[model samples]
Target chain A: MAKGRELKGRIKSVENTRKITRTMEMVAASKMKRATDRVAAARPYALALGDVLARLVRPDIAERFPLLRQPATTTRVALVLLTANRGLCGAFNTNLIREARARIAELEAKGATVELHVVGKKGIGFFKYLGRNLASERIDITDRPSAADAASLIDGLTDRFAKGDLDAVYVTYAKFKSALSTPPSTEQVVPVVPPATQGTPRDFLLSPNADVIVEALLPAYVRNMVYRALVETVAGEQSARRTAMKNATDNASDMLTLLKRTYNSARQAQITQEIAEIVGGASALQG
Target chain B: MAGALQVSVISPEQVLYEGTATSVTAPAFDGELGILPLHAPLMTLLGTGTLRVESSEGLKRFHVAGGFLQVVDDTVRVVTEEASLVG
Candidate 1:
């Protein structure tokens, strides 16, 4: 009876755990849908911006724009690590942290001073535990990221790059390829790599002139890039969470089935033992 | 059909409009620039102002902040970050 009761308790707890995980899985799935939609919606603007920039930006003009200026030597660099605020997602935060660590190591190996900027609570906690210094840490950003959020995040870095204060800037995040695949990756946002000019150049009318327009356009392009990374990371996080929760729920169900069967068998064994004891007492008294 | 221009107004968040329009007036950096059908290819930075899109149905207006406008082969693409419908 004691064994049966214990198994019953375990079964109840596992059922509760399964319920929670099931709820989480559904929530994550819905959020993933919306996040993926956002990633798709943001694409047209990026493509059109790239198209215009490709036509306007050339080798000579690129030299004039400070944001597009390539530093002759690698000395100082900024690594912006993007992670999720919460840690329920499996390996999402861990992968990003690992990628960032590797990136920092690579930069340090090249004799560059890396100024680490981390976003999300998970990343901040991990770096703090490691006793590493963070140039900046922000917990305000959430799954619902906006263009203003992106601008606020990257504008200062872009300004420093333009001022020649920083040699280069890199952002590490999970790139959402599909619901099944989101790989951790790093991209250099500074020294804007101009997209290869498509087709032949056309003599297009430029308002005021090319220099003024390019100056204004380059920062917008950078902002778009940051926004894209933010949205993609959110999508990846939700997808990872959904998969993790699904697996957890499945495991809980299997455990519950096994525990229930054990509990039933234990209860039946106790009943048989009681019947046998009563029958033996009657037979002994009769004899 | 020959006179109408294929227009796409895209923001960072979503595509606000994608259809044929008679003309598009965007807030260029220096000043307001208007695009009619068959306008020469042009690229210009946008300023914060009202963007007007005239079509057969009516005139659609948007409050656009920073971005650019591109015109090529009768396709007017208005790409801006801060854009919302204006009443």
Candidate 2:
């Protein structure tokens, strides 16, 4: 009876856990859909921007823009680390932090002073535990990153780089490849590189001329890149949470099955022992 | 068909319009820019204002803010930070 009671308690607890995980899985799935759609929505703009940038970055035009100028010496750099605000999403944050640490090490090894700008609570906590100094900490933008959020996030970094205070600017984030795969990636976002174009150059009616437009476009381009990263990171986090919750739910189901079998056998054994005791008493009384 | 340009007005969130238009006018950073069919290749920064597309179906307008406009080979591409149709 005691054994049966203990098993019952365990089964109840496991059942409760199963319910919680199942609900979390559903929530994550819905969030994943929204995040994925956001990423998809931003793609057209990114592609169009890329097309325009390819044409705008002529050699002469490229030379005039400050963003297009590569520093003579890469002495100072900034790393914008994007991670999840909350935990329970498998290795999503861990991988990003690891990637960031490695990048910092690499940059430091090359004699460049690396400034750490961390986004998300998990990254902030991890770095704090490690006693690492953070240039800035942002904890609010992980759940719903708007265009304004992206613009403000990179505004300071862009300004510093333009003023030659920071030589290079890099963003480390999890790039959403698919539902099952997201790899942490580091990209140099500043010193705007002219993406290669395939066709011959065509003359354009210069409205305020190409040089002026290029200068304005460069900042917008940086803002868009940051926005893309934020969107991708959000999508990746949702997918990771969905997968993690799904695994947890499946494991809970398996545990429930094993517990049910144990409970049934324990009850059966107790009943059989009670029957044997009753028979033994009757037989002794008759003798 | 003779005086129409392929116009695509794109925002970060979605593509507002993608079709043929007789003329397209957008708010450039410096001022307003007007485009017609066979317009030479042009690239300019956009400002916060109204974007009017003169299509055969009638006139459609959108409030656009902060982006760039590119015209290449009779195709006009308007990429903006934000865009919404004007009621």
Candidate 3:
């Protein structure tokens, strides 16, 4: 049985914890809203670029551009991994690392060489422990990153591809599914996938011939794809944090409730014991 | 036919501009390069400077630094290192 003083002290401690969790929850919610908006705003560029890319990848342009050509061998691949700069959210980094491990194992089983361009401290830590060879690395890109950053990485990747250093390039990150669920997703960001051509791509008249247009469009395709992925990654981070903070707040509340019950029962038991002692003394005096 | 090219100026945060332009001028690595409708299929490294595009309204200028320009058919995709508009 806890004394009133002890119960009050315990409640105060729980209250302090609750306040901290509540504050975190609010911060996470604000970040989630901003991240979601950024992701949505970036989508048009991604889709429009894809449309232009689809038009560029005609049978004719495929003949001219090495990037457009389908590879005869699936021997080696490079993955640029983006993850959280920090780790407070639940299972966000875990899911991505798990996905990457499985992917690397699969590639190894197929006798395909796998290289990595690790972005964020999470990826750096994960691969460093595994002693994996990294193609390139950048850490701590959690906040908003400009298109210029994307270009620097893109230049590195494209140069390697141009020199035939890597056969394919992929980007791995957590895709923002919703507030409660962010799924780890991997997409090919390099050797840009030509958009699917269903409509009559030839219907639109080109200022230049289609060949020139195709030539001009490939890099734009890459930038948009990378930018979209980053936006989704940021959104996913916010969602994960919001979800984690909410759970924390809920857990703290439950703990407070349980503590309160224990405290009250303890309080009642002491009162009853004290009353019994006093009444028993009165009865004894009368006897 | 030659004057119209699909030029999209985009930033990571938003699609800054997307429309039909009669002519487009970009900051190419070597110098400023202009594209008319029937310009050659070209892949050029971008430089920091003014990105000029002609539309129905008049000439639109974007202050840009570094990127790449890819021209295919009627589409000109300007991937700028950094871009801001000039009034």
What are the C-alpha RMSDs, in order, of all predicted structures? 1.4, 1.7, 4.9
lDDT of each residue in A32-78, candidate 1, tens digit only: 99999999999999999898889888898778889999999979999
Model 2 lDDT per residue over B1-87, tens place: 466799999887778899999999999988888998887778888899999999989999999988888888889999988899997
Each model's backbone clash number: 0, 1, 15
TM-score of chain A, predicted model 3, versus the true chain A, to 2 decimals: 0.92
- Write one digit per residue (lDDT tens) for candidate 3, span A1-287: 43777877888898898898789779878988988888887776666556656755667657577566566676778888888887877888888888877887887798889888888888789889988888788874657766666767676776677567777888888887776777998888767678786555444434345665566567666766777777778788878877887888898899889889988888888989999999999999999
Instruction: Please report, as a value between 0 and 1, the fraction of native contacts recovered by candidate 3.
Output: 0.31
Candidate 2's C-alpha runs over 4 A off are B1-4
**RMSD, model 2, all Cα superposed?**
1.7
How would the docking of model 2 be graded? medium
Candidate with the greatest DockQ versus the true structure:
1
- Model 2: lDDT of residue A214: 73
lDDT of every model, 2 decimals: 0.92, 0.89, 0.76
Q: How would the candidate models be sorted by lDDT, starting from the highest?
A: 1, 2, 3
Across A1-287, the per-residue lDDT of candidate 2 in tens digits comes to 99899999999999999899889889989999999998998888988887777876877766567788888999899999999998889999999999999999999999999999999999999999999999999998956688889999998999988888999999999998998999999999997777788678777776777677777778878888899899999999989999999999999999999999999999999999999999999999999
> In what order do the candidates fall by DockQ, top score first?
1, 2, 3
Candidate whose TM-score is highest: 1
Which ranges of candidate 3 are over 4 A from the true structure?
A1-10, A202-209, B1-9, B17-61, B64-82
lDDT score, candidate 2, position B48: 94
